[model samples]
Target: MKQRYHVLLCLLGVIGCLLFFPRDLSSALTFTPQALYDLTASRTGQAAAKPVPFVSSGFAGFLDENGRPQYVEKIRYGAAVSSMGIINYDSVSTKLVMRNRDGEIQVAIETRGYPFFLKERLLIISTDRLRLKEYTTDGDLLWSATFPSPVTACAAAGNRFLIGLLNGNFLYLNEAGEPLYSFTPPEGRIKVAYGAAMDAASEASLVVAGIDPQTAYLLEERNGELNSIESFPLGSDLRRNLLVSSLHGGRFAIEQEQGLLVVDRTNLRRRYFSIPGRLLSVQGHPESNLLSALSQDDSDRFVSMIGSESNYRGRLRLAGYGPGTSILWSGNRFIILVDGHVLVYRLELI
Candidate 1:
């Protein structure tokens, strides 16, 4: 009788430890806002003076005074430049490139793709194919590749890369473009390629999150195999018009009818923040630990900078953030960060 009673007590102790210890322990692993903010701020500061203007002329894809496309010239440096729907910026060489449906490349000098330090390489994808390119600081292509199928979207985690396809397929690759593993979705109508990122909390893990037709999927990859899949329903309103803007590193950002959704790969948890009006554009700042949203207001536009739980709204201006949500800087003319210095410009739009 005494031994039975002691065994019961030990079982109860194990249960208590499981319930309480992991919760508190996980909380301690999270980032502290002060520490992140200080690390970011130390690397960013206001520029001594306004940026020197890099001017151009022409509109509607026409050339400017210096014989450059108006759009390209305007965003030559720190712009959120997108082409063929893929967005990326390089700070070392100070260039931004976008791919268009026609397979044309747009290069700009000043740009809105700020917090410029995050993107070290370029990612390009399409419905029937995929490509990875290395670049020099002067807009020179270092190397490029064409993958197997029509790639819908892509994300990079450290030295690993994740690519999602229109046929509900995905491939994991090393930095050198060697195949590690592949996965297929359970459903066929999963035409849209939502988002993907590396799972930092787990070793050799990748998270592919997206809306497949009317359902949302969180697919987990470990040891070159997809072992678990979690599904969530976003209801009619959000499900009907789901759009995913960006996924890189271990972060995923999605835009649905309800608002913007951000998820961390490590925790398998998510957070939603409402937009004041309809969203025009959304992008993730990997290094700065912030997400940017642009909305149309009358003739002008407004940009909102949102951190994990806090919100700050500003007018249609240029801006950038440092890694891990550490620093935020903006300006009226142009916002460009070169070697940790913020450069704002006054333009003479010709």
Candidate 2:
């Protein structure tokens, strides 16, 4: 009788724990935030007042107004300009080349017409009404693919890119610029692709988030096909600016005006956390729903730790510092570009 009573008590305890903590308790790991050096503050020169395009690798970078990699590891700027700086453009097309301090042609893309974006080392050259082209950091032509109809939106990352078309359909392409998957919404449900993200290997799932008439659509790419399309109702005009970003291995983040919506690969599990003010950007944590976001206040931006049990944990250590910043990478250490500075910080959240 005593042994049976003990077993019953242990079973009751387990039930109580699960009822209180329903989520995956194992996800609540300790995450700490650490600060590193600043780019402009550590360098000697001032950047051109104009906003210049910048991109960073692990330690080096090509800041605005210059086509050379500054050895951020050594804290030295303009110290090692590379000889590959001179780009020989094709006579038939108008092209621009980005040369790093290492003299390597980090990017050589022709964006004479339509929209052009230089991300990391890949050059995204697009013709809004037609096709898109991509180039490698070494000026190598990766691939060029065209669409069936007019494209309304487009985004790229890691190993793939996506384009939203006029017919309420979206096309996804690999790093080689080959079209891999296409998804079309139900007839008359048109949403432009405003943001997109995929796992590092592009093997888990691709998230394409967008808006049309205040309705947001979410598409999931899986197993060489697209399925599990979800449409979210909008609360305000913020739905017009729904932005999507990769969260983790099989999750993604969507930034609406009120807060953020995070979804797993299956498209069944999801969560939304309301934010206080206008969010400028959000960097998702590598392991949890917890994230770091930049919120705007009177034209100045501050960092906020979000999605904690408190909903709003607190301000980040480097809050309200960089304007027009971008989170370069997310993992144990997060690198971001604020103004002309590339800052690195250690991140930990529980």
Q: Which candidate is the best by lDDT?
A: 2
lDDT of 2 by residue, 273-316 (tens): 77656666777665655677766555445566665534665553
TM-score, cand. 1: 0.47
lDDT per residue as tens, model 1, 1-350: 69545544543453355345421212222111111001012222222132222211110111122221222222333332222222334444434455332224645433222322213454432223555554444455444556655565566556666677655566767667777777665542444444454444333333333343444556566665666556555532332233454444555565655366766555667777776444555655545555667543334334565655445433333222212111122221223222122222222212
Q: Which portions of model 1 miss their true places by more than 4 Å?
A: 1-118, 123-145, 188-190, 198-212, 219-229, 235-251, 277-291, 297-300, 305-350
lDDT of each: 0.42, 0.51
Best by TM-score: 2
Q: What local lDDT does model 2 show for residue 207?
A: 36
Stretches of candidate 2 exceeding 4 Å from the true structure: 1-38, 41-93, 101-121, 127-129, 148-152, 155-160, 174-176, 187-191, 201-224, 236-241, 287-289, 307-310, 316-323, 327-350
